[model samples]
Target chain A: IAGITQAPTSQILAAGRRMTLRCTQDMRHNAMYWYRQDLGLGLRLIHYSNTAGTTGKGEVPDGYSVSRANTDDFPLTLASAVPSQTSVYFCASSDTHSTGELFFGEGSRLTVL
Target chain B: AQSVTQLDSQVPVFEEAPVELRCNYSSSVSVYLFWYVQYPNQGLQLLLKYLSGSTLVKGINGFEAEFNKSQTSFHLRKPSVHIRDTAEYFCAVKRAGYALNFGKGTSLLVTP
Candidate 1:
């Protein structure tokens, strides 16, 4: 289908290690976002890109970084993984025409030890 | 800034019975409201949205919601729910930005 695709559907990493989650979209949407879903915190925005070559932080941006090298890819990296950072990460994309609608990926489940 | 609140963390209902999922939001400026459904082991999908126009908005799969400006609420309703409708529902709010603020989510359990 022509929607968001997230990589590393599930992973386990030791503390102090580095990890990266890959996200790609074929819809050519103008905006993409990274969000972390927790037990009772809902989904908090980690980072976002309005267009290629530009990026911005979201509600919870600490310990995480993102880059929008092109319109189709937005990768999120964790320099030093921590147990607290372990959660389900989702990548989403949207366009001006869709208004507030967001197309989400299946999600990446990461566990830190 | 925008924030969403889903009153109930979980709701239990019987099949073929009506169900209501409550959602409330807080925002300073004009806002857009949306409801999303996530089935088991799946990504979230847009159920419906309320941008502008009438207060009532109908969505896919016999789902609908009313945007109440006075109460700052956008609660979802279904005339009759089925076992297939068991899923997690989320309420989200968006301002003039590309990101959306979401609620904790409400899990609907439709039993036989």
Candidate 2:
């Protein structure tokens, strides 16, 4: 089974443009998350969903929004891309929300110019 | 609130040598700890985790971590390193059903 998959493997967007990064998981997990990885900063949480139809704000959720309409898919959208948003984005899911062990998808690298 | 700290930003070691990556965390309540590794241009993968069990937790790829409640630390260690072990390692903690709080990753470079 494909554990997790992210679409638009790489993208280049001009500043102020809108973009959406798609993520899907086959594990039927209840928890899904969005994170951005930058040099020397590690991965910072952008937003998360405890379960389908329920999303929460994370540490760094300024320019991004997420929706979890179904169990298998969660998408992150950037209303207006900025150079600061240029980073590798990752999607992750876990069988249970309480446990910290996560299954991650190959990242989507976005470059905003 | 929960936070994680990875003491080292970069570690350089020769193959066959033992290596340790230090990690410490702070939380108001009891929490679970985990270590994740990311290879070049790859997603993060679980290396190991500490739940309610023995202090020592062994994981895939000959890596292990010890959870010290008193010290508030979960340091990852491998007895012998290989060239394949070169990657960025992250320390993460979760408190009461919250998403993981990750520390600044430590890049490990295993040289031949």
Give per-residue CA lDDT, model 2, range B8-34, as digits (tens): 999999999999999999997999999
Best by DockQ: 2
Clashing pairs in 2: none
Distance from true position, residue A50, model 1, in Å?
0.9
Model 2: per-residue Cα lDDT over A2-110, one tens digit each: 9999989999999999999999999899999999999989999999999999999998999999999999999999999999999999999987744757999999999
Model 1: CA > 4 A from native: none
Quote the lDDT for A96 in model 1.
56
Candidate 1 local lDDT, A2-94, one digit each (tens): 689899999999999999999999999989999999988889999999989999999899999999989999999999999999999999999
lDDT of 1 at B93: 92
Q: Of the candidates shown, which would achieve the greatest TM-score relative to the real structure?
A: 2
What is the per-residue lDDT of model 1 for residues B17-107, given as tens digits with 9 covering 90 to 100? 9999999999878899999999988889999999999999999999999999999999999999999999999999998765888999999
Candidates' interface RMSDs, in order?
1.0, 1.0
List lDDT for all candidates, in order: 0.94, 0.94
lDDT of 1 at B109: 100
